[model samples]
Target: MTTGTHSTTAAGVARPGGPGPLADRTVSRVGYGAMQLERVREGRAAAVALVRRAVELGVDHIDTAQFYGDSLSNEVLREALRPEDGVVVVSKVGATPDPGGPRPMRSAQRPEELRASVEDNLKSLGVDCVPVVNLRRMDTGPGLRPEGDQVVALDDQLAVMTAMRDEGKIGAIGLSSVSAEVLRRALPAGIACVQNSYSLVAREDEEILALCAEQGVAWVPYFPLGSAFPGFPKVTDEPAVLAAAQSLGLSPSQVGLAWLLHHSPNVLLIPGTADAGHLEANVAAGAVAFDDATLAALDAVPSRSQDVPLG
Candidate 1:
């Protein structure tokens, strides 16, 4: 497999900009997912600039959620792209949180409310239709309910999403924050993508990743760079990865992402960063190619150095 190929988009990234399953959608296989754009102590100014620069540097896909800051992220996204065109904007619903203060979360799928819920997302995004509507599946929780009743006992949130696909409110469907069992619940629906916690430190998803590859479904692995995992194996500290990086003259993070690009063509990397330098470094990783010897060494590295669970 080859690596280190990013297309230039003077206007913005267009789907199918490269090759493989992502080619049909204009969303680059190595596209940037925008969940990390949320403001911490700083406001949206820096994040907004980073996103705009991502477009300038040719990242075709930008994934987001209505629940991120109660649609405030979408608003910031809208403001940032006041100039570019032809970018694929993917967003999700299922959890809506308070944007102001005293943060609280709520689900908007009550069967009766499913239709309205999608409409709110369209309005919030300022787009007629979302390129993708990932059903934020939370099949486990207290006081948390699904849209339908006793009809489908398992993963009721999925039932509502399947109905909406038939109703035509969603274009292409996806799933997020799902378990292997919960993900299996969505398999019959022909979902376009699945975002789960998986990285060098979280190898529990290796099975799921292989399954997605066999099914020809896009696997958008989130937190691939050890997102706060207990005893997270520092990608920089990994002996083999460090040696490979030294050989290739790249950063450890870049080498980690390059390994992910090597994981499978179905794997779409969405490593997030608030800093511009970090963003460029992440993008450069897509260009780093590993030789057969380096790949074999990397393959020998255990998927999870620690038995830590995915976050």
Candidate 2:
């Protein structure tokens, strides 16, 4: 059951995160992330059902990558959605699955490799053109790093990405895990959105977030509730956060996610989960409104840099 009692009408009033822009489409600010679908223990059918349930709950933006679960995420999306559903399907490149390697993924950052990855996503998702494709640059990482020839130039990668957009293989281009300078350079390519690690506590990417805001690009944060990584602090663990949650009659996670929404108007969330109940709570986070005192308390929770990678 969802913890939020807020409801939405046909106009999308009071809906999760309300509606925001992504590329050429206006989508629910509280969108779904399909990466965790790869680990659903309930089988593919259950995964499909969860996606459908999200759609039913007013989710229209979905963030995914071809490297996730070796394209299993795309396959599940293919089975669960149709183009007419009007959902904006977003994907990323710059890496591919490497099941037997030390890491579950390896760099495929070359221009040609990115093109191939886009083609693979097209085939797997059964779509002629993906709405948005984020070029996940390995500049600074809490994840895989590019090596040798795999370290491709941003302009070189953008050339092919722009070409694909011109060819209609991708509707728009986005960037992920990038620095402010890179985003500034790529702005000429017409960036539509950015996916970076940010949260109430993890604020190392504030410069990048500010740049995106200035450029009118959507800020889709990946780890909105911090991460499971050792050095990363969970937002729920903060005493102030716990106190706020209790006062509001909501969970700590809801308060954490709501803070992002309140922090920035352009911020969009792609909080992922396989459990049906958890999905409801995440969506309900959209309804979370804060008083000035609560907001001040959360704002004073002390920002820290998440130095460790989220992988």
Candidate 3:
């Protein structure tokens, strides 16, 4: 399945996207997002089984955060996987459980705080060092600009990750929910990947995705199904996307994910599902292919980024 830096199908066909540049290893472009593990009604054992199935289906990237389910995601991953499973585990820092909300995320941006967050992830995941760690910008949500005083320079946060890398606590660094301008400034500091909320109907990060491709940074897009935004139209509801799916005899989710893989060679998918059946369906999306007509139809779907802002 693997040859040098590329992962191929059993028939020797090339995958939709090539090997990720960050880990520099053979990896499937379609990856598993671990945030929904805690929401599964069957509880921890079922969550662990879903993770195992993802790997069995050839998933080579798993994205999680310490704050996801108050560290439940990483804990479940610890029970299900070992480093030898040959997958990259990516976690993020800069947000912690908010004391005010029923259960919301808050900023935790100091260097010491970031360092502690990294150690917390290490402890939870039971890994000597995570394959990749992303520094999420928490001062502002994904769609809005930050207040003048709230801005935290990328270099300041990079210093924390750089120190951790020097000490052998992390193998690579990444950025999440940041603007293209910020990514341009941060590239000199060394970024292996960039995580952002992008989907068939949400394209605000479009420029950032192109920049990542140009710079050889992996672009990991979360919420590819458009379900993360509770108020907006789901990808399945888009007329063009729905039509394409009907024509191909595929689910709307599969059509949406296949479009992302066709959108860019650097784009990496992290679609998440709590149910085992949904997990397998998400992985099967990797096989859906699009012709030029389908690609154009998907591209015309309106951008829904304004409907739901990510923070």
Largest TM-score belongs to which candidate? Answer: 2
| lDDT by residue (tens digit), candidate 3, 9-124 | 33244443445555555567888899989888988899999998887777768899998988899999999985667778999988776647754666676677789899999999
When superposed on Cα atoms, how far off is each prediction in RMSD? 4.6, 3.4, 3.1
How does each model score on TM-score? 0.80, 0.94, 0.90
Model 1 residue pairs with clashes = 4-287, 15-26, 15-27, 16-23, 16-26
Error of 2 at 9 (Å): 9.9
Cα lDDT tens digits, model 2, 146-208, are 779998899999999999999999999999988888999999999999998889988888888
lDDT of 1 by residue, 16-82 (tens): 2243354246355566767667743367787778888877666767788777666776877787775
Best by lDDT: 2
Number of clashing residue pairs, candidate 3: 0
TM-score of model 3 (CA atoms): 0.90
Where is model 2 poorest over a 10-residue stretch in terms of lDDT? Answer: 1-10
Order of quality (lDDT): 2, 3, 1
Structure candidate 3, residue pairs in collision: none
